[model samples]
Target: MLALSHYNSSASPLFPHFSNDSAGKLEARVTVEGVTDQPNFSPGQPTTGGVIVVILSMTLGIISNIVALIILANAYSLQRRRTKATFLLFASSLVVTDFIGHVIPGALVLRLYLSGGVHHEDSNSSDRMCQFLGGSMVFFGLCPLFMGCAMAAERCLGVTKPLLHSSLVTKTRTKICLCVIWLAALCVAMLPCFQLGSYTYQDPGTWCFIKVLSDTEEVDVAFVVLFSGLGLTSLAVALVCNTISGLTLVLARLRRKPGSHHSAKSHDIEMVVQLVGIMVTSCICWSPLLIFGLMTVIHSYTRSIGDDLLQYQTLMVMGVRLATWNQILDPWVYILLRRTVLRKIYLITKCQAGLRGNMLGRWEPTSFPSSEKNEVNQV
Candidate 1:
């Protein structure tokens, strides 16, 4: 949800000076005699219930991400037997970014709750913390989305130009691509501070993001062109690439007319599922916030302070929660939808249960999913 930010020294008294921006940062004013201070949309410690909920989310998200990482590591080790797919490095990088997106903000948001608005307790320190956390959240949150775009693009290259892809999409190149993803995310997140766009804390005070609304025509144009433009571009590219890749697998399977084996068809289905899961989950979780931001900017909605806006703020908080849930789900997407991670998880379970009899060798896989690389992407 698009939101605003501000800090009120005390709880909003009738008409509290706390106003929010499109980025969800609260804007506050300090009156020195007759002159009013600039707005500071710092976070406020709202209900502990919110903190408790996010803490649990953070816990689950962290655990799932760790499990995914372990599965990837095991799968990567096994991959030494064959030509390791460079695709896995992208997958691992995405998971890492998703983990950061969850943990870092989750902790900072928890502090905002536990400390009861410590950011407001001292403006100087809080300002510094806000700047850091605001940028950190934006960078981490957007990084994973773009990384998905990178994955989609890579898959497209692999399908359309296999020989070239095999030659060009090397381990070193994949690493470089990942670095570029992070660097790009960092640059976009910092643009708001330069007055090109806006970033701020929103209602409930746990999250900060790009401003969705513009106070003037000039800023409104900038917000639309940069903030919404970048988000939509990345999401559109990801969706298109994933859709094309999924269709290619399905068509390839369909084309295997006479000698089409059951396993081959199943592999096509699995690929479709994985790609669809990623695309759908991402859209469901993130599209609302971005779309709403665009609409608000176009309409030129004004950011207002006081208790009257609390209901609107409360409703909008749902968007933020959904986006956070995406972080928890990304790792699950890998484990549940991808063949390699799924097989690893299955083996790990058997191992922990002392079912060595089920094991073929020290680390050899006994599952059908892992028996053939032609069926699924490695890791």
Candidate 2:
């Protein structure tokens, strides 16, 4: 009776045979087993607003990431002079995760829009496609989430142990941490496919995920619960890490004995301010999806007695879209907060002296002591 969350899909990728029974086999039967109301999962295809949102998300996300990757890679290539290899590596991991995160899921959403929507019951091929997309969404989406936590932890270390952080968190160490995050996300994504739960259709017709609410055992509630649980836990860790890091910076500044270089002090305070903004924005964008997941399990948020499914479905769209909005905003947030982006632009425009002064003033240096690298400029 519960509609679960947006992660629901029509077939289990790990156990394809369970949903392998042909449509012909069920033709003589009035109803198919294990299949709930497919129609209820998504009331309709994406409306104009939904279509516009996804389109804009995919378009700009691609452009900004491509630019980010280029500038960052170039900066890192000159790493021996600019900063430690550790910062460069972590920055690269984040850009890669974010780019893939946006493109992979964005493509699936596009396919659903193009096909007028689909389900595993539509065909065996379609079944596999949905399973693949559903599994990928979980994997790719969580990669960025975990990476955010890792970064916050790094910042915390920098504030608490600046000297040790520089020596201890090396390139090899950072790579190991990145690997662990990816592997954990992969393992969690595989859970639903392996029969811990199953993916099924969700609203707006284009999306599929592990069902949050269901009347059948084959696609149980445990998987949906697991998905929600992991998501919230990661977010909580990120918040704690960022909060501690921000507070530490604040306290350090307040305790300063004065006579410190005003330029450097002001810059350090700005870096902390920008870092906190990123952490807060990330939470704002992602929290909606997790909240809906929690609300669905507690009780169908707006689907109780005398309530309309349309409104509940509307709420569902808002939550999923809110998560999608994060993918679009991330690169831009990086651009805005990035300390080196303006510097790079300024260097290229020096020949235009009339504009150089304005650009230089606007893009003033706010270097972090942990890594002089501009790409490490933003968390």
lDDT of 1 by residue, 1-379 (tens): 1111233335443333433542323232332211121122334545656556656777888899999888767767666421234656777778888887777777777776666654423433226566677677667767877877787787776655667877787888888888888998888777756776665555445455554422335663565556556766788998888778777765664465443344433433444466567767878887776665555444444433223334344434656667777778888877887766555665676667776653223223422344665543333
Instruction: For model 2, state the Cα shift of residue 311 in Å.
Output: 3.5
Q: Which regions of candidate 1 are displaced past 4 Å?
A: 1-45, 80-84, 118-126, 212-217, 260-272, 301-315, 340-379
- Which ten contiguous residues of candidate 1 have the minimum total lDDT? 31-40
Per-model TM values vs. the true structure: 0.72, 0.72
368 Cα displacement, candidate 2 (Å)? 8.1
* Cα error of candidate 1 at position 175, Å: 0.8
Per residue, candidate 2 scores C-alpha lDDT tens digits across 1-379 of 0011233234222112325466755643423322332243433344455556567768787888777678668757865631234545665777777788778777877767766665434523236666777777677767767777777777677667777887778777888999999999899888865677666666645776555543324334455566667777777887887788778766765565443433433333444554465567667876776777656534432224122334545565676767765666666655666555444454455546656444234333332333445454332
Clashes of each: 25, 12
- TM-score of candidate 1 relative to the true fold: 0.72
